[model samples]
Structure formats: structure tokens, C-alpha cells
Target: MKISIFGLGYVGCVSLACLAENGHNVTGVDVVPHKIDLINKGKATIIEKDIDEILLANWEKGNISATSNYKEAVLNTEISIICVGTPSDVNGHLNLNAIYQTAEQIGAALKEKDGFHIAIIRSTVLPGTNEKIGNIIAEHSGKKRNEGFAVVSNPEFLREGSAVKDYYNPPVTVIGTDSDFASQKISEMYEGINAPIKKTNIEIAELIKYVNNSFHALKVSFANEVGNICKKMNIDSHELMDLFCMDTQLNLSPYYLKPGFAFGGSCLPKDLKAFKTMAHDFYLESPVLNSILDSNESQKNQALNLILNKKSKKVGILGLSFKKGTDDLRYSPVVELAESLLGKGFSVSIYDRNVNISKISGTNKAYIDKHIPHLSELISDDLKKVIEDSETIIISHNVPEFKDVNLRFSNKHFIDLVKVKDIVPSANYEGICW
Candidate 1:
């Protein structure tokens, strides 16, 4: 594969050398004369481990070169990678000036180039950026997208100290493109790397880097807060965190990491409140912990607003419990949503296969009686009847029956709090946060 990478900066320099080391003929392009001069002289543009040696060795083998002529580089190579910096501005927004400039230059070069060309965006950018780049290229080159050329979003996952190693050994290689030809070519370019190739849409690939970095920042701040509380209690925070990390079932797993409706189970609500109160009693400021409940409340209201905004007077809830296949109505978010709908003068009907009003006893009865006095009147065991009587339906559980409810009834509006796998987004169906 012959490749041209724009912006001979940190990521560009390492990628050029490493790809060349992987047997791909690479050309480094830049506007800076000194950076181009250094690369042409068989010297790396950045200070990193093993990059200088790799670049020098690849240069000696004639697999690597540098040039400031973007037109010539694009005409020679089959693929072009945009690795220009997307630094922050005064208002904390990304200034994509360099990225647009590089895109324009590549588009101009592609004007005279023949055959299909693939341009990969290796910089961290927000969603919808790939579409904008594709549009820019189409406008400049006087060709349609995916007709003569394609734009791909393939973000880099390289750390500063281990950039060379990280390039070869990443957790996963993400390729986001609409063109099948581009996806195949990009996959072939990374054929030797020992990592799973995750092929997705362009927007998802573009937004993943921001999501990863934001979660990493949250983890660091959360750990610091826990350490602060542990110090005040004279406990070993490191040991406690090590033990916490060992729990692969829930704590350190993907158990609760999903975008959905508010969490309203018995253990979670009770324990989260307990932790927040404990920190408050100790005079500890745990913003992250304290904000959890507020965020959950906001999610509940968001679901409520989505239903209310539909302007339907009749609403149906598919599941009444906190989870599926369970009769536990204790702290169920769907139950609260039903109660709110009733309060708003909207007729509400509910269907739960597992929830039997006549059989429920103890705290479950007490909770329902206090929150919704006319529970028996609103509850129905027949699934089709509940869906038929309501104008809008809320599917909170990802059950098999709820999956095709949207498909079967195309006229009724469907609000999905849980992203049911089989449910497709259409005019009558909408997910809460997806």
C-alpha cells in the first residue's frame, strides 16, 4: 500500500514510520519546511522511542519519503491520512482549521488523480465531521462521494511514551466508512496488526475517541475523590481500589455502562444514597457521587417529557417492574412514569406478565398502594389489549415481545427507554438516548 499522511506532527510522524516499518510505502506531507526537511533527511520529526530508528531504517530501504507537494503525494499514493492537530481554542471548542486546510489540499490533489482514493481521518474529531469532509472533497474535486473517492474516520489510539508500540498493538482498530472498497483497503492496510477490526458507521468511529477520553477523565477524578475520603478515614485507598477492580462481575465490567432510562432498582438507589449520605456526614465533597441521583432524576423527567411532547392522551407501559421477568416493583422507574402520566390527566394502561396484583404482598403492595392507589384498574395482563388501548407505548424492558411491537403497529408512537435490539427507528419509534 502506498500511503500519504498530512501534518508531520506527533501522530503523523509515528504513523509514517510505523506503517513504513510494516512494509507500506509511506509519504509524509506537511506545510512546515523544517519538518519536511527532517523527514526527507531520514530523521524523525518528533522525539519518541524507536521512531527515529524505524524512520531511518525505512528511509534507507526506500519505503519512506517526505514531501511538501500535496498534489504529487496524492497522485502517487492510493490512500491519504489526515492527522493534523485539532487543538482547543479560547472558548474550549476544537479549532479544526488545520484539518479543513488539509482536506482542501487533498481534494484539490484528487482533482487530477485517477481511480478511487481513500482519505482517513486519524485525528480526534466530533461526529458529523466526516460528512463535512466528504462534502468539502466532493465540492473541490467536482465528483460525487463514494463515486471517485471516499472519506474514512480511523482515529489513532497512541499514548505519548509508547506511541511506536501502541501503533502496532492497539486494543482495536476502528474503521468507519460508507464505501466497501475503502473499508476493505483500510483493513488490508492493517492486516498484520494483532487486533480486532471494528467496522462501524463514520459518525460512531468519529465520536468514540471523545467518549473514551471523557470516561478516562471521569475515572481519574472518581478515583481521586475516593482516595480523599479514604485518607480521612485512615483507610488504604490503593488496597481498597485493587479489591474493587477485582470484581469482574459488576464493578469493573460493562454491567451498568449503558445509555438508558433512570436506574431504579432496590439495591442501587438505596446504596447510592447511603454512600452519598456517608460522604456528607464525613464533610467530604463528592460531586460525582452526589450528582448521580440528580442525573437519574433528570433521565426520568426526560422520558416523561418525551411522552408528553408527543401530545398523546393515552399512554401504555410494557413493563411495570424495574427489570424484566421480575415482579419487583420496588423503586421501578416505569411505575413512577406511569404514576406521573396518570397525574397529568393522561389515561395509562400497563402490561407486565410477571406482575400479578392479586398475588403481590408485603413491601411491594405497600409501595404500589402509596404511589398508585388505582393500580388494579390500570394493570392488565393482556399485552395486545394494553397496546391497542393506548396512543403512545413505552417499552422499558428488552423482551422478545417488545422487540417487534414497533414493527407490528406502525401508527402508534413508541418510546424506547431500553434500546431493544430488534426495534428499528422509524417515524413512530424513538429511543430515549440513542
Candidate 2:
């Protein structure tokens, strides 16, 4: 397969070496003449682990070369991977100048084209960016997406300095496209790579990368803050964290990893309170750790505010479980939110795929039912009826067919707690916090 990679920076250079090593004929394209010259002369431009060897080997084998002309790269290659950079602007939004310009150039080259050429995006971008680029290309080339040529988002997860290893041993390869042709083409490019291929919607794939990086950032901040507090108290933070991580049964494990309700179990909520109490008892100002519960409560309050702002006499909720796949209602913030709304003037109806009325004979049911006694009567098993009845839909979880609900309830508006779509609604759509 002949492949053209735009931009010879870290991502582009690593991709060129890896693809070339995988037996694909790759032409590296970049604006800088030095980068192109370096790749063509069998010298790697980027400083990555094992990349120099791979680039030199592939270049010597006549499988890889570099060129400065975008026209030449696009016209010759069967697949074009847009590995351009999307750096942050002054406002921290994704600056896609390079991406837009590259798309236009690719479209110009495809103007006199006749074959199936797929434009794959390997740059980190917000959701809907690839769709926008595809539209731009389509407008210029007079070609339809997934027909004349396809556009897909294949975001790279390579960390710098170890990119060569990360490329071949990635945690996951997320290819965002609905077209089978586009998916197959991208998948074949990584034929020998050992990684799980996650085929999903473009927006979900885009958000996954952001979510992963942002969570990692959060963990770093948390650890540092804990270390800072431990230092203030003349304690070894590393020792504390080391001991904390050893308990995989509850802590440092997948115990709180699921996408469920807002963390209201017996141990979590209570222990968090206990930590704050202990900190205060010890005269330690632990605002960073203490604020976690407060911030969580604020999120729940935001949901409650959205529901209350609807001003509807009767409001219907699609799911009652804290999450989609769980029945544990302990400290499920949604349950508490529902209880709060019921206390107010608004009448609330609830639905859960996993929860039922007869299954409520246990202690959990008794605890929840004690607060809202009309629970059995308000629970509905059917979703169609829920959509038909609710004035405003508030999607709490990523329940199946929620995307399909947008078309069904055209009249009803949505207060999306989860960022479901790429382009958020202006008039009828409101995200909890985009």
C-alpha cells in the first residue's frame, strides 16, 4: 500500500517509520525542507525510541522517502494520513489551521482524481473536526464521503520519546468511522500491530483520547497535592501512596472505574467525609482532597437545576440506576436528585433497565422506598411511553438508543448530562458542562 503522511513532526515521523517498517511504501510530506531532506537521506527527524533504526532500514530498503510537494504525495499514495499538529490557541481551543490547509491541498490534488482515496486523520482534535474537514474536501473535490473517498479519525495515542514502541504496542487503536471500507483500509494498515481495535463513532473516539489524557492529568495533580499535604505534615507521601496502591481490592483498582451513578456507596461517601473530618481534626487544610465530594455534589446539583428549570409539572427520567448497567442504588445521586425533585412540586417518573419494583424487597429497596414511597407506581418498564410522556428529556447515562431518541422526540428538548453529540444544540440542546 502506498501511503502519504502530512507533517514530519513527532507523530508524522513515527508513523512514517512504523508504516514503512510494516511493509507499506510511505512518502513523508512536510512544510519544512529540512524534515523532508532528513527522511529522504535515511536520517530520522524525530527523536523517538528505535525510530532512527526503523527509518534508516525502511529508507535503505527503498520503501520510504520524503517530499515537500503535497500534490506529489496525494497524487501518488492510495491512502493519505493527515498527521498534522492541532496545537492549542490562545483560548485553549484546538487550532486546526494546519488541518484545514492540508485538507484543501488534498482536495485540490483529488480534483482530477478518479479512484478511492481515503483521508485518515491521526491528529488529536475535538469531535466533529473530521466531519468538518470531510465537508471541506467534499465541497472542493465534488466527491461524497464514503463513496468517492472516505474520511476517518484514527487518533494516535503515542507518547513522545517512546513513540516507536507505543506505535506497535498501543493500548488501543480507535478508528472512528461508519464506513466499512474506511475501517478496513485503516485496519489493514495496522495488520501486524498488537493492539485492540476499537471501532466507534467519530465523536466518541475523539472524546476517548481527551478523556484518557485529562484523567491522567487529574491523577498527576491528585498525587502531587497528596504529596504536598504529606510534606506539610512531615510525612512521607510516597510511602503513603505506596501503601494506598497496594490495596487493589478496594483502592487503586477498578472498584470506582465503572460508569455508574455519582459514587454514593457505603464506603466511598462515608470515607470521603471521614477523610475531611480527620483532616480538620488534625488541623490540616486539605482543600484539594476535600473538594472532590463538593465538586461531585455540584454536578448532581447541576442536573437537578436543569430538571427544575424545565418547569414541567410532570417530569420523566429514562434511567433510575446511578449508571446504566448497575442496580446498586446506594448513594446513587440520581436517586437522591429524584427524591429532591419529588419533594418539590414537580412529579417525577423513573425507568431503569436493570431495576424493577419486585426486586426491591431487600434493604436497599427499603432505604430508597422510605424516601420515595410512590416508587413502584412511578416506575415504567417501557421506554417508548417515557419519551412520549416527558416534556424535557435528561439523558443521565449512555443508554442504548439514546442517540436514536433525538429523532423520535423532535418536539421534546434535551438536557444532556453526558456530552453525547459532537455539535451541541443551540436552541433545544444543553450539555451539563461541555
Which residue window of length 10 is worst by lDDT in model 1?
420-429
Compose the digit string of candidate 2's lDDT tens values, residues 1-434.
Answer: 99999989999999999999999999999999999999989998977779889999999999999998888888898899999889999998889999999999888888878898899999888998889989888988898887888888888898997888899999899999868998998888899999999899989887788988988888887888678667767999999999988999987677666542355655678888886676677777777778889878887887888777788767777667666677767677778887888889677777777887778667678767776778887778888787677777777766555655666667777767655534335566667765
Name the regions of candidate 1 deviating beyond 4 angstroms: 424-427
Residue lDDT tens for model 1, 1-434: 99999989999999999899889999999989999999988999999999999999999999989899999999999999999999999999999999998889888988997788999999999998999999889888887889989999999999988999999999899999999999999999998887899999998999999998998888998998889888888999999999999999998889989899899978899998997788888999999888989999999999999999999899999999999989999999998998899999999999999999999999999999988888999999999999999999999998888888888888899999999877778888999998
Which residues of candidate 2, in runs, are more than 4 Å off?
247-254, 274-288, 309-339, 346-434
Q: Model 2, poorest ten-residue lDDT window?
A: 417-426
Q: What's the lDDT for candidate 1?
A: 0.92
Q: TM-scores, in order shown?
A: 0.94, 0.76
**Candidate with best lDDT:** 1
